[model samples]
Target: MAAPPGCFVGWQPLLLLAVLVVLQGQQLRADFGLPTAVMGGNLVVRDANGINGVLNAMDRAFRRFNPTGQTDRLMQASAVISQIALNVTELGRSVAGSVIKAASDRSTPVDELFAKLQEKYGRMSRYLDSEVQNAIETLNKSIGSAQSLSLKNALNSVAAAVRQITNSTADVGSVIARIHETTSGNTIFKAVDKASIPADLTTSLSRALSNTKDQLTGLSRTIEGMLKNIGTTNAFLARFDQTRQATEKNIVGNQQGVKAFIDGEKDTTVKRYTNTRNAIIADISNAVGKLNVFGTNQTLLALYDKHSEEYTKIYYYLFNRNESDIQNISSAFDAIGHNMEKIVVDSTRSVNSEICYNKYSGQVINTFPGYQNGVVNCMTREKNRLGRITDVMDRMLQLILSTSQDLANNVASCTVWNGFDKSETVYRQAEACLHTNINEMAKFGSIIGRELDLVQTLGDVEVAASRYRLYDCVAARNNEALATIYVLNKDIDGCVSEPGLQRDVLGGGEKGGDEDTEDPYEAGASTTEEPVYDEYLMEVFSNSSSFGDDVDKIM
Candidate 1:
């Protein structure tokens, strides 16, 4: 009943037994299958986590990397541009001030001219006074004469003629002074006051008084003609006042209009530029923040594998957004371009207005002095004529007053000074000074025009520089963003291709099971063979072993 040495009675057939053991091993391996899925899931999850982490890291790096430093540098450059623009503006202001001062300096000549006019008017006043006195004396002498009837008629005619001349002289003097006052700041008054009067008024007044010796010159033709001349002079004076008033009013109105335009332009232009620059800075900040948030290696890797499509979409979206921001920046620059055009137009208007004012001033300055001189000369001639008449009357009157102590002491001994000659000389000198000032004012105006042109050119250059500098910075930022997008896309693609990610996340296929093998007893030749051990190795193994006999036996 004992089993053979290599076989037992309870043992099954070799093939069946081998198959059973192999199946058992297969079952054991199968028992670990869920763990494999878990491990695979862990690998996929790690891959996703790693990708996300890398992307986040990259994003952090990008965000942390400050481009603001470059932006600050650009801003500094803008400040430099602003400084240049300010310099140009200041230059323009300086030129304008200089020109204005030059124009005002012409007032010196104008003042001198006015003085000459006053002197001429004074001489005429004195002449009229003397003529009135002479007429009174003549009338008195006639009344005392024995040829009373004829003498009375002659005295009356002389008296009437004298009154008419005095009246006309008074009217002329009043009109001339008013005209001079109205154009006081003008140079022409000096020249006119200095020059000689024309023959017409002198000849007419002389003739009118000459015939007055016969029957009280009944409103003589000469006096009437002199009155007509006075009327003509008054008309000219009125016209001169009107012209100056109108010019001044126009200049004031134009200056106000230009000031309003310039203020509006500055406000609008500065607001537009500031708003645009702020908007651009805000957009750049946002875009950069976004880049920082999503540009990490981990996130890019995760996006590369699991969400490549989304990654691509986001990348392009950011790119397009940045491009849109750049376009907006360009539009802002376009607004600045419009501002530049407005400034140029305003500058042109200002220059033109200044030039126009200067031209009008020059014309007024040139003409008024001569007009004043002529009026003065007229007054002077009238004065001289009246003086001769007054001189004759004074001699006759002196005979009457020779007995009075006060008359003898003050009036007789005192010289009758004529102011006409002195006034004429002053008028001439003043007129000369006015001429010089007018010429200088014209030169200053020309210089101002040139300075304005230079300022405008400098302003244009500054605007161009500002626009170009901003454009360069924006373009550079846009290019950088685009490059980042490209890099992120590549990283996402690589992550998507990894085998670890494909197997676990994609659920493509299961792993192979453990294989079966032949039964050891059936395949072996000997069942009782012992493994050999060396005694020296056994002693060394025994001395070092904690499980003494078993380890020693195995050795």
Candidate 2:
């Protein structure tokens, strides 16, 4: 057969034909050793009979077995094989690029995580508002209750005083005239008539009324002074309001500042961090995108180097090149692959190192909203205490006003030293004077009784203390003198002992052995002992005797 157009013939074609035949069989099992199995699978070797099957089909087309015809047939087979290798290389690049692009995509998870963080921040703001409202409500309730109780107490005190005064004034005439003369007047009103009594008796009665009036005036002045000093409790409330307002402003400002800081952190720091991480992921995706090109170039370089020389000698192989060209091609492909791989590996490391999940672990800043509540609680407690104090001052003012007004009314009606021409009015004034004297004297007697009881208790305490080994002798002597003085002051002539000993001593001392008719004085005195009166004791007795004589003279 004659050589066809644009064809060449030589021993190189024969050897090339034999080499292609051998290579086709091995190419069916060739492993390109790609970095990714996905790209490798797209290569022709993945098929069991990709190269060999095609060659066999081409071989079957050559029925005329002659040298010239065989050379033409071998050349046609190489062209077909080259075309198939190029197509498979393109397919592998496309498939590998798609896989890497899919693997490197991370925008979805990033968006979802950012949205979740934003929701948490929103919930934090809501929680602060709810907490503040609850605290304020509780504070208001506490202050309100305190104010109510204070007002109630003041009103109840005023009501009690008014009721007492009303009962006392119900029957003035009977109240003034009613008197039980069961015992002698011991202190003030010994007799009703000034002519029948000592001058001192009248003087004492006048002094009593003057003193009562003076006490009322003094109390009124004191209340007026307090009312003037405090003026109104509004100042306290104003100051408290100022303090509360300042506290609230500070608390609100702090809460807002903390919230703003968190919001700023999310916007600036957290956003920047997320953006940086996402950028790294994008870079890795770009590197992965380049991996397909590098893989395709490597495959093409190997194929061109292996078959270019043979294709050039056999027939019209347009891609014929030198050994250095093939080596440069391989080197370029290797460099690109190395760089892309490095970018992929390094960018992947960066993505892996990113703190995407739970970025704000324990990052919440405590604004101490409870500190504001504590301030409120303390302020409210102080306000409540101040309110109570104001209530007490108001009650005192009420008492002084009411009592002074009543006294003024009484004094106006019961005028002092009106002429005899006043008739019944003069008599009524005299009666009021006598009644006041009697009331004052009765009060004095009760006071003296209480004083005596107190002294008795003191003496008993001292006497019981004498039983102790450490009791001072001087104190015991003083206590014994006090006891004797108390007995004598009570008009008991004999020394007394403990009540139990008194019962034992007086058991058979009753008249005709009748216990019911026992004398109270003898029963009270456990033993009737004659006291050895010292000088101080005698002086006390003489003063007491003088006191009694003065009382008798006044009567």
Candidate 3:
């Protein structure tokens, strides 16, 4: 095509095509290898085909080959080929602009790949079933016996297209590879980064990569097979792509296993560290808890030892002799209380506890919600009972002292060493005093015995020990009464032997009537079953009296 003289190109939409056409003219002219363009400038209009005239030759060849390859088949193929050519042309224009833009911006140039239904891939891909294939099928159906010549031509066209897919994919791969190299580090970035495709490109990019892989894999599998590679499949695998699918599945499985192993190792390490930390903490806590208990119990053990020692000393004091020292007894009691106060009651002051019980049974009962209070109350009652035992012992001690003073006074008055007359008077008086005091002591002894029983049973140490002293006192008084009765008989018998006294009066009394009334009372006999002197003491008194009488007869 030739441009008009002084042509003014006003079509803005077709400006790129017009420029390409002008370049095509200049190319055609210079291809003669001449030094200059003949009668020309750089400007001229051209057809859609460049100087190679590939579309033009296809037209002319189909027409010339029509005798062998029929005209109708050629015409049908021509339409589909023409559509494919148009799609390629448009895709090329768009890609060229994008590439130029990429060269300027350092961005991805293969913009067409992201498009699902673009001209180059989507429309051109349809040609496998469109004109060239349709023409071959039509001619094949028409054939009665021999293969049609037109079918061969149609097949050649289809073969050419299939070859072009292979050749063109290399060019597309190079462009995509460059884009991949540029975007590898940062998958998602500005305008032409990996985001331009979706899992990170690993989002959009993975899809793009998967699409390329599937296309290449499908192409490789497809070209390796004949018609059998087209459509048949099972649920397990696409029959045409079974080998490639298996390869991809194995690769994916390996990647997942590697990821899972790394993750498992990380989790195991974390769990191990956590368990170690917990175990160490537990050990530390256990050791510290034991140490704390050991430290806290030192005072408790000391108090127990001290209490035991004091308890021993107190028992020794109360029961060791016929008389117990109240000071020693009080001191031991107070010391034990002090130890309890420090060890038991001191800490119990702050401690609160929940105490529960079934309360329906009928009995003497005291209840509180807190166990600390209950412990305090029990300790107090124990102390009170101990105090009550001491009080009982105190009363018994006072009674002993009173009775002991009377016995000592009466024994002092009766001068046993004097000659019988004066001694007899004092002795008789002492005997009457002894009898009265003995009887009085016996009454208190019964009382003390009962009190001692209670003290021994109820009291822990103090009152239980006092039982010995009280019993000793009672025995001592009984012995004193027997001694007094024996001395009185000796005094009265010796006085009868002296010159001043008569024997009859000495044996009984000064008056016979008085002797009948008073002397009827026997020595060492009492109204109650418990005698002031036991049988042995009474026998000692009677025998000594008979000895005095025998001594006077011998004189």
Candidate ranking under lDDT, highest first, comes to: 3, 1, 2
Evaluate residue 323 in candidate 3 and report its C-alpha lDDT on the 0 to 100 scale.
31
Q: What does the lDDT read for residue 146 in candidate 1?
A: 18
Q: lDDT, candidate 1, residue 538?
A: 13
Model 2 over residues 108-226: C-alpha lDDT tens digits? 33233323333432332343224224432332232222222322233233233323322322221122222212212322222241123233322332333233223323322322222
Off by over 4 Å in 1: 1-227, 235-259, 291-457, 460-555
Window of ten residues with lowest summed lDDT in model 2 = 546-555
> lDDT of model 3 at residue 153?
37
For candidate 3, which ten residues in a row score worst on lDDT?
355-364
Using lDDT as the yardstick, the better of models 1 and 3 is: 3
lDDT of each: 0.30, 0.29, 0.31
- Structural similarity to truth (TM-score) of each candidate: 0.17, 0.20, 0.21
Off-target runs (Cα >4 Å) in candidate 2 are: 1-194, 236-262, 294-555
Query: Candidate 3, residues 404-450: lDDT per residue as tens digits?
Result: 34433432332232222345554455345434433443343354345
1-555 per-residue lDDT for model 1 (tens digits): 887887746545677778876665444322211111221222322322332333333233323322222223222322322232233223222322222232223233333433443343344334333433443333223111111222224324544544543443333334334544554454233334312223333333333333322212221222222222223323332453455444434434443444444344444433443343344334333322332222333422232232223333333443444444434333433434343233222222211211011112344233433433332232233223332322332343333223222212321111122221356554344334333333432343244334323333434444344433323332233233223322432333111111221111000122212111111122346632222111111110011011000000000
